[model samples]
Target: MRWQKQPVHYPYEHVVCYDLETITDQEMQDGSFPPWPRHRPVAGSFLTAEWSPVGYRFKLDTLLCREGREAEFYRKVDSLLPPGGMGVSLNGRNFDNAVLRLQAQRNGLFDLRNIARQAESSRFDVAHLDLLDVFGARPGTSLAELCRALSIPVKTSVTGGDVADLWRSGNVAAVKAYVQEDVIATYILHLHAAAWREGHERQLVLPLADLAIWLEGEPGLRHLLSFATCRPARWARSRAPALRAAAALAEAELRLKREQDEAAFSAR
Candidate 1:
């Protein structure tokens, strides 16, 4: 919780890792997979790490999916994604993003905002980090497989295929819990990549406190407080003092940028 602020300078504001759960049907089983976007999204969730007193913490959310509520669910998802921040997912380019677009179309909504643009980019683009593309377009390997490859823990008691049965059985809580698990696993994978970038070659569990320290002078912490959009609850009450200090520094820096830009415009 106490580290000298190093020269932090990450490219994006934050890294949000997400995934969607869809309802399946017999056609999916028959491999007669219709043009439908990889099962109708019954639920979606995202997880983004933040600087918390508890070390590096995460803000997690689940967007419940329903027939008439698809658009609303997407809106909630959009609200979490800040511009210039990165979105992370496994096979999201082909499956999850398409699901969002198709549902948005059905609901008479097309303004997907950031997600829409991310979907349009090449998977290698930083707009959205598709792990499948990160590892040489190994499309056949599942996210779980990729996690195993990285030696990161993979926890999922239920598969996406099982979601439809659980929904039909009316076990809504189970489905929600499952979706959260998927997103959390994805978040961990993102962390693994970050560690690797910092020259960590061995697989190891990342400590929450270490996350804060690791991001301390790095680019990851730079944008933690600089985005124009407000990030609610970046830090818990337990860490209010630290959060306030970071916010103050960010505000001053932002003000300086605005003044510099205005002066440049005037001179021009």
Candidate 2:
């Protein structure tokens, strides 16, 4: 694993791990400061997970922004996150939050800026945790590199450098998939960091097991199931409670869906 600039600290219970996909402006020259802000966000993905006694439960979703609808993407992100929930990203302090802050300022999005600031800062009241920063700044310490060191299975289908071209070529699904992988990987790392901080090594695999069970019923996230749940078999016996919690959540969701369907049919 890469060296951490600081100990694995911060005790926030709710976390939103996120990643952004961006495209550069056609008119602007290369080599821009605050590189992400110069580019526009075409899509983003966030994984929301809240800690429970059993483990963390994950819900995954993505946001798509057509060419000029960047502000709407920011608004949707702001609306989706819980109040004061911790934000996690790979290089979020420098890249992701920087982009958000700069773009938010341009669009007069003070609320989004505030959220980004809170997530980017390392102050006493900070609500964001940048795993890249936590791992310390060094060459060869990108998300993929860190994942490799920690034995996490990250998506190898595409690289970040390919995202802008892929999106321009109309491969939005690929971009979304890439972003989802990055965010999920970040969340897994976050769980491990939490486990490290709390001195509970078992905390690592339990959340993965729970997230795997939760993903079983989520068709949209099937791609992540195997990658996210790597090496959880050893924890099978200890994962009973987390599995039960996941089952309950899945059942509740299905029941809610049925109720909604029945109500809609009744209206007809």
Clash counts per candidate, in order, are: 2, 0
TM-score of each: 0.66, 0.76
Candidate 1 per-residue lDDT, tens place, 39-110, comes to 678888777765433445556677787767777887887777646778888888888887777777777877
Give the number of the best model, judged by TM-score: 2
Instruction: Write down the RMSD of candidate 1 (Cα, Å).
Output: 11.7
TM-score of 2: 0.76
> lDDT tens digits, residues 59-165, model 2?
77799988577678778877655566777777777677677667767777777644565455773334777776666655246888878777777766998778878
Looking at model 2, the pairs that clash are none
Weakest ten-residue segment in model 1 by summed lDDT:
225-234
Give the TM-score comparing model 1 with the true structure, all chains together: 0.66
Candidate 2's displacement at residue 65, Å, is 1.9
Which ten contiguous residues of candidate 2 have the minimum total lDDT? 27-36
